[model samples]
Target: MVTIQLITVKVTAEPSDAVTEGDTVTLTCSVSDVTESMRLVWINSDGKTVVEKTLKEEKQEQGLLQLIIQNADRDRRNWTCVLFHQNIPKVLIPYYLKINMRARILPDIWIITVSSYLFVKLGFAVGLICCLKRMDRISNNRNPPKATGNKETVQLQTLNSDADLRSSNK
Candidate 1:
């Protein structure tokens, strides 16, 4: 005669705690009665299987699940630990993952851009002023007062002759 035993599988675990990025966590799942034949399944929020094992594989039905989040900007995911035996579901535990982006720097490139622009504007203004001064000097040399036949030119010549006479007398 063959006999079948009714087994009660009760899985218990420590309450989940908050963890930072790149943290190592140890999750323990224990089944009552059939501790030696229990199987454990770990599933993420998206219903994706992460790990599955039987009690024969490791003692304490424990697993070391490390959270290696490559993209910190992504949303947190839900993790579940399911315990079963003989293809029958026994217990379920849910854990939440919290992820955050570590801000490293603030942009100060605007300050540099504004300063460079102002420097260029000031340099252009100074260059324009210098160019105008040089142009004024060139125009003055190119078009000097003409010696027109007028009273002003006559007075200028009389003064020049008077200076010449005085220099000879001296």
Candidate 2:
């Protein structure tokens, strides 16, 4: 006498965590208990069958199924795998396909902030230099240096001594 145990088929998707937007995602469905006859099916969060366009391609191998999602976008919905036994499709495991949006310019938020700060600092420095130069030019233009006549002249230093130091007495 022998007893039979049934109901032990579970399916799981690859990258069982998350996916990034604009990146290709591969959801490979593999069954725990391999059986003689089993079929794989993919369904969306709305329980509707997924279209072929959404799934670029599919591969089947040794009780395993593969699904390719191309151009991953925010519009993508969560998906789950189903296995069919005796032509009756049953629920397997549910996978949450999270399309993570990366930062547009930089991956880290701090890098962008630091770069912005540097650019603003540089701009302020340039503005200050230009302002100072313009002010100096205006001041110089307002005040002109005094000029003497065209005749050549000599500057003589006056002495406080009572005696004259000149060689010829006048």
Candidate 3:
């Protein structure tokens, strides 16, 4: 005679809703009647399977899985945990894990951008003022002032060397 037993396992996860960026979500799988053959696993929505090393085994019946995301800039996918029964593989437990990003940083970004632009504009204005000042000095130095039309002349008396010599001999 062949006999079949059906059993359902329960799976639980933390933060039923979405989570923030750079955070970790924990998933727990439990079986009512734990057997040595019970297998618990966590799978991502992307169809990639989690490694055994990352999963922490709480006990024979319950298994704890932690999923840490790199970042949550946008809406993220879901992760589910499935359990394999010892007698039959029909019974399953699933937990959905959703991660959410925080509020948008558009305001901060806008402020920074506007401040930078204003700083650049102020720097250019100062630079133009300095350049104009330098140009004015250069032009003034390049041109020399002209003399007036009216001029003054002076005369000086000269002495003959021969007369001076004769006077000295006398």
Q: Give lDDT tens digits, candidate 1, residues 14-45.
A: 32554444444444444444435667777767
Per-prediction TM-score, please? 0.41, 0.46, 0.45
Provide backbone clash counts, one per model. 0, 0, 1
- Model 1 stretches astray by more than 4 angstroms: 1-17, 21-33, 57-76, 107-170
Report lDDT (Cα) of residue 33, candidate 1: 44
Over the stretch 1-170, how does candidate 2's per-residue lDDT look in tens digits? 99763545354444566767777877766554443556677777788767321111233234556777887777664777787766676656787777788657755667888899999999999999999999999998999765465333322332223247543433
Best-first order by lDDT:
2, 1, 3
Cα error, residue 28 of model 3, in Å, equals 1.1
Cα deviation at 44, candidate 2, in Å, is 2.3
Model 1 local distance difference test score: 0.61
- Per-residue lDDT tens digits for candidate 3, residues 76-95, read 45656665444344444455
Best by TM-score: 2
Pairs in clash, predicted candidate 2: none
Please give me the total number of clashing residue pairs in predicted model 3.
1
